[model samples]
Target: MINNKTIEKFREIETPFYYYDLDVLRSTLDVVKKESENSGYKVHYAVKANSNPRILKIISSYGFGADCVSWNEIAAAIKAGFSPSEIVFAGVGKTDKDIGAALKEDIFCFNCESLQEIEVIDQLASKQKKTARIALRINPYIEAHTHKYITTGIEESKFGINTWELEEVIKRLPSLKNIRLIGMHFHIGSQITRMSVFKSLCARINELQIWFSSRSIDLKIINVGGGFGIDYENPDKSPLFEDYFSLLNEFIDLLPGQTLHMEPGRSIIGQCGSLISRVLFIKNGSNTLFAIIDAGMTDLIRPALYQAHHKIENLTSAGNIYRYDVVGPVCESSDTFAKHIELPETRRGDIIAIRSAGAYGEAMASRYNLRDLPPSVFSDDL
Candidate 1:
């Protein structure tokens, strides 16, 4: 949370910028590391969430592995001080250039999404005279009950390979001598608040494990991709990390000597960040009032992209409360943060804080509308 002192500092910066509470982030990482330390669970920070160089450096300093989905993300992780051996690449599509870059770096593993991807990597690895370790990313058909766009584990999603194709994939593996099938991966969705969805995934994985045992195959690693949700309503509330890790331990039965891995992004960084903006205009509407802000979907897109909500506050106001439809300067009608939200009577030039934006806030910002990108200010720096 930004204190009065921090709010004063915010007034100095330009209107629209990201403010990260490093104290909150470091404490959150400590909780994650302590909770996962019980079972030696390897956690790879998903770089897609927030690849800010400083954030990456801080996370990497804790010796956490990195999970990347693009060649540039892998390069970013390495540049941020994450070791190549601790980096895992996962994505539905990998260009030859992407594969070749990972091959040269000798990345930890590739979470292969299809048989053709495996063959392509094998071909590239053979040309480089190297062996590529891979994990078959399986679509377990589990419904995470999240937004449609964020769901990736369902069979209809074009993410991982369907379960029915497992046999054919195994059959075709003999011809690819340069690739090794190491582990299995599953990612149900993003912003997954339902615990039962993960339990269902564990059941499906157990069934898959039995099928693998029947084939006399021993999996060395089991990477259950992360989608733990954060408390958007309460920015100060910590996520249920201890309970989540405990639930996984109680339900998921691992084979002997099998290592477990996870990719957590939002739950670790979401609440610690906020987008501070200044109210540009206050206009009266037929029913509600409009508090137009300088920040737009171009700065924080979850509201426009996922229909997501973030807590809004009047940082410099303590007057009577009023209802407002907080909106941005973007031309899109869909660029709204909240509707009929209650905030202190706001005026133009008043600082407004959009809470719980650390994860996808600045990371997803764009140059849309030719708007300059928002700069970041850490709590420690303030």
Candidate 2:
């Protein structure tokens, strides 16, 4: 949370920037490290969430691994100081260039999403004369109860290989000469608040593990992909990290030489960041008042894209009560930030904050409408 002192400091700077609370982020990372250390779980920070070089460097210093989805992300993780041995690459449509690069770098594992992808990687690795460690990404079809756009574990999603295809994949694997299938990976969805969904995932994995064991296949790693949601409504409240880790510790059964790997993105940095914007204009409609801001959907698209909610605050004013529909300067009707929001009577030039934007916020930002991209402001520097 930004205190009055921080707000005052922000007023001296420019509007439309991302303000990161490094203290909060460090504390969150400490808790995560403590929990994972206690439970003997290996954590990989998903780089797609917020791949700012500084943030990634800080996270890398904690000895966490990297979960990358593309070639650039793998490079970013490496550039951010994460060792190549600590990086795992996963994606559905990885290009041949990405595969070649990953093989050259000798990354930890490629979370293969399909049989064709497996074949492609094998061919690529064979050409490079390198044996690539791989993990089959299985689509467990578990419902994450999150926004549909972010859900990847459903049957209709294009993310993972379904159960029916497992037998075929195993049969075809012996023919692929350059890839070693060493593990299984499953990622149901993102922003998953329901722990039961994870328990269900664990049960499915246990059944699959037993079935594979019967076939004499011992998995060296079980990559349970990250989806731990954060407290968006109350950004100040710490997330239930202990409970989440304990749930995994209690349920996930591992055989000898098997390790549990978790990819956590939003839960680590979500609450520690906020988007700062300046009120552009106040418009009046028949139904509601609109507090127009300079920051558009291009800056923070979660609301317009996922219909997600973020706690809005007026950093410059207080006490006066009023209602407003917080909106961005984007030209679309869906460019709204908040609908029927209650805030103090706001005027132009006042600074406002959109809270809980650390994860997908900056990563998803674009330069729509020729708007300049927002600069990242760190509390550590202040």
Candidate 3:
């Protein structure tokens, strides 16, 4: 729960900033560590979520590995105290520089997306006289039932290696001496709520494991990449970690000497943070009220892009209720945060908290329209 006294303190700070409940984050991390350890699963925290330095430091202290998508994220993970051996790099378009950096750092593994990427890593590793460890990211074509932009496992998506190409890929893998294929990686989508979808993924993985074993390939790691979702409506409830883990344990059959790994981003940190915006004006129309705020799409784009819903709260008002189309000062009409939102009679100086924004919210912030990005504030004993 958001501390009322902390909400009061927010009134003194300028609006359009991120407010993180560090206590909630610590508790969430505790549960994740305990549950994953109990199941003998290794967890790599996705760096694309909220890479705030303080937040990353806190997470690193809990001893979670990192899952990075870019060279900068690798650097950030290293700066946050995560050892290079604990980092896994995954992305479709890794640049030459990025590959060189990963090879230099000697990270754990590269989740290789395509045959061309595998060749490229092999070449890069050969140049540096290093053997690159890699995992083939396979496209299982599972429909994650999520937003189209975030889904990645379908045949049409340009994310992973297609099924038909696996045989030829393995044949070619023996020729590439600088790269060692270690495991398999799969990421169906982001913000997925259906546990059944993951069950299907596990079944597909089971079949793939048999196919690999037939080719004399024994995988050391099975990385079921993260797509765990959070309850955007109820931020207080813990994420469905138990059901998520149990589904994998029940369905995913592991070979001897193989290890299970999971990359969880949103499920771990999405609900622990909120976007704090201050109302600048309250314009009244014939039947609606427009609560114009200082924050816009540049600060939090999920509401505008994905039409995502977040619980909105006015921390100061208690009068009669009214419907408001909460908007920001951006020039585009589609830059709205919420429409037909119900709140108490709000004033010009009230602070509104957009809840459940710790994942994509801060990670996707931009400097469009020349607007400065909002700073982050944490609830801690400072």
Q: What is the TM-score of each candidate against the true structure?
A: 0.99, 0.99, 0.98
Which portions of model 3 miss their true places by more than 4 Å? 285-287
Candidate 3 has an lDDT of 0.92
In order, what lDDT does every prediction score? 0.93, 0.92, 0.92
Q: Would you list the clashing residue pairs of candidate 3?
A: none
The deviation in Å at residue 150 for candidate 1 is 0.4
Instruction: Give the clash count for each candidate.
Output: 0, 0, 0
How good is model 3 by TM-score? Answer: 0.98
Residue 358, model 2: Cα distance from true site in angstroms: 0.4
Could you give candidate 2's per-residue lDDT for residues 68-183 as a string of tens digits? 99999999999999999989998899999999998999999999999999999999999999999999999998999999999999999999999999999998988998989999
**Candidate 1, residues 1-382: lDDT per residue as tens digits?**
6789988988888979999999999999999999878878999999999999999999998889999999999999999999999899999989999999999999999999999999999999999999999999999999999999999998789999888999999889878999998899998899999899989988888899999889988789999999999989999999989988988898888999898899999998899999999999999999999999999999999999999989999999999999999999999998999999999999999999999999989999999999999999988888
Give the distance in Å from residue 59's predicted Cα in candidate 1 to where it truly belongs. Answer: 0.4
Q: Which stretches of candidate 2 lie over 4 Å from their true place?
A: none
Q: Could you give candidate 3's per-residue lDDT for residues 1-382 as a string of tens digits?
A: 6668887798789889999998889889999988899999989999999899898899889888999999999999999998899899999999999999999999999999989999999999999999999999999999999999889999899999999999889999989999998999999999999888898999999999999998889899999999999998898877978889888889999998999998999998898999999999999878778999999999999988988888889988889999999998999988898899899999899989999999999999999999999999988842
**lDDT of model 3 at residue 302?**
94
Clashing pairs in 2: none
Ranking by TM-score: 1, 2, 3
